[model samples]
Target: MNELSDNEALMMESLARGIAVRAMKDHGAVPPTVLIGNENTVIEYASEALADAAAKDRLAQIARLLATANDATVVTTILESWARIAKVPGGPMTERIEAVMIMTEHRLGSRALLLKIERTEHGKFRRLTPVSVPGLDSVQGRFTGLIPPRSPSPEEIKQARTVLGLLGLSPDGKTIRHDLN
Candidate 1:
């Protein structure tokens, strides 16, 4: 993807900040930052800035938008319209798209999966976890070392389910089915 120019980055950041502010005011909670790009559209929202009740409500609103978005263009259009409504300056469309793609593909957020490391009781170290997100067909044994030792926290599990859901995987997390027909 194309790199974002300094001006474009500033514009995009401004637009995101504006949207977040508006969303916060309307719902009484800060909304997620949206990144738009081909194959990389995503909304990374943190709701803690507002009151606890407001934050949950705002997060739910953000999640709805994210869960329903199916394409990058749609996401960009939505953000552009939001900016216009909020009177925020818009960024270069192409740069926004590219940034979105990079963000989504890399999963750049607090929830993004970082490197997986494993330590054994015998002081041995192993790094056999797959770098890619797991699919339905991905065997549990392949990720035995990667899966969290205890059940994932609700938020973490929710994020995982969302990612898997975006990839069209089953909620059960057993296997991947590509047949959309």
Candidate 2:
């Protein structure tokens, strides 16, 4: 697959932010408190595929502390450790893992407090909003409040059929023939 271009990356970040904000609202989590609790879960799950013995051992220790202690220090250490691990140099998989951790940090680090809107050309407005999702730095403007048309009345349908028939189309719209001599 082709890598995301600048525009695509920006769009992806915007989507992530919107989704994260929605998730936080649904969970009733206040700003800076992510719904995905227990940082240790991240450490354990992220480290599960590691083949390095030292990394596994380190993860085991972090898991043990997370399982037993409510100490703020332990929690902070675990979070920081995961953050560092997320930065470990590797390939695409490693980059993805790091992105997850970065997103987690964003979600748990700030609360969206304001929405700013600006007018653009063509009677369109651009809205800039904050979101909680990782990697999604800014939410983009969207056109909203469009009302769908109601179903057409019988008279309207009949009129449409008449128009189609006049166009040399069958009532069922399956047959058409044109001849010039």
Candidate 3:
């Protein structure tokens, strides 16, 4: 992956915060005061600030977005597009974003993984390791440690299942595996 310039990196952080804030507003969430903080600050702080202020419906919307994604690469690409549109750097995808992607992957397989994203450095994040569910493990463990725990609503799961099926994926035992893989 290409390394982003300092200015470009800051722009990406700002863009992410802007996206989060928009999501909040679109979902009727009363955004947290911290959202108005420095845009170049840590991404985790921005994500948490938006998350804290997000109404249950807003959170559900965000959760559903994460849940329906097919994989981390696709999720990363979606995130990259935002940065690309702003003509900013978007390398070394943030852990918080990765957390949402990985969480969605596991949740689609019916695993309840919970995680919290915390700020570390600017444009960076750290997530709490999710507790493993006994007898329920991902078949494609390609992104084990990167995943955060989160359970999707039944409706979200249904939608995700439809998406996965379209992508040629299906749950086998405790894991969701692609048929062609």
| Ranked candidates (TM-score, high to low) | 1, 3, 2
**What tens-digit string does per-residue lDDT give for candidate 2 at 37-154?**
2322321122233346665554444332222221111111111112122233342323221112112212122212222222247534333342123433332211110111223355
lDDT of 1 at 115: 21
> How does candidate 3 fare on TM-score?
0.20
Clashing pairs in 3: 113-149, 113-150, 114-149, 139-175
TM-score of each: 0.25, 0.19, 0.20
Which model scores highest in lDDT?
1
Candidate 2: regions farther than 4 A off:
1-4, 29-181
After superposition on all C-alphas, the RMSD of every candidate to the true structure, in Å, is 21.1, 26.2, 18.2
Cα lDDT of model 3 by residue, 88-122, tens digit: 23434333322221121221232223222333575
> Number of clashing residue pairs in every model?
7, 2, 4
Candidate models: Cα lDDT each: 0.33, 0.29, 0.30
Name the top TM-score candidate: 1
| Lowest summed lDDT window (length 10), candidate 1 | 95-104
What's the ranking of the predictions by lDDT, best on top? Answer: 1, 3, 2
lDDT by residue (tens digit), candidate 1, 1-181:
1343333333444555455445534553333343433234333433333345665454344433343332222121111111111122343322111011111221121112212223357534333122233331222221112213233456765675677566554333233667868
What lDDT is obtained when candidate 2 is compared to the true structure? 0.29
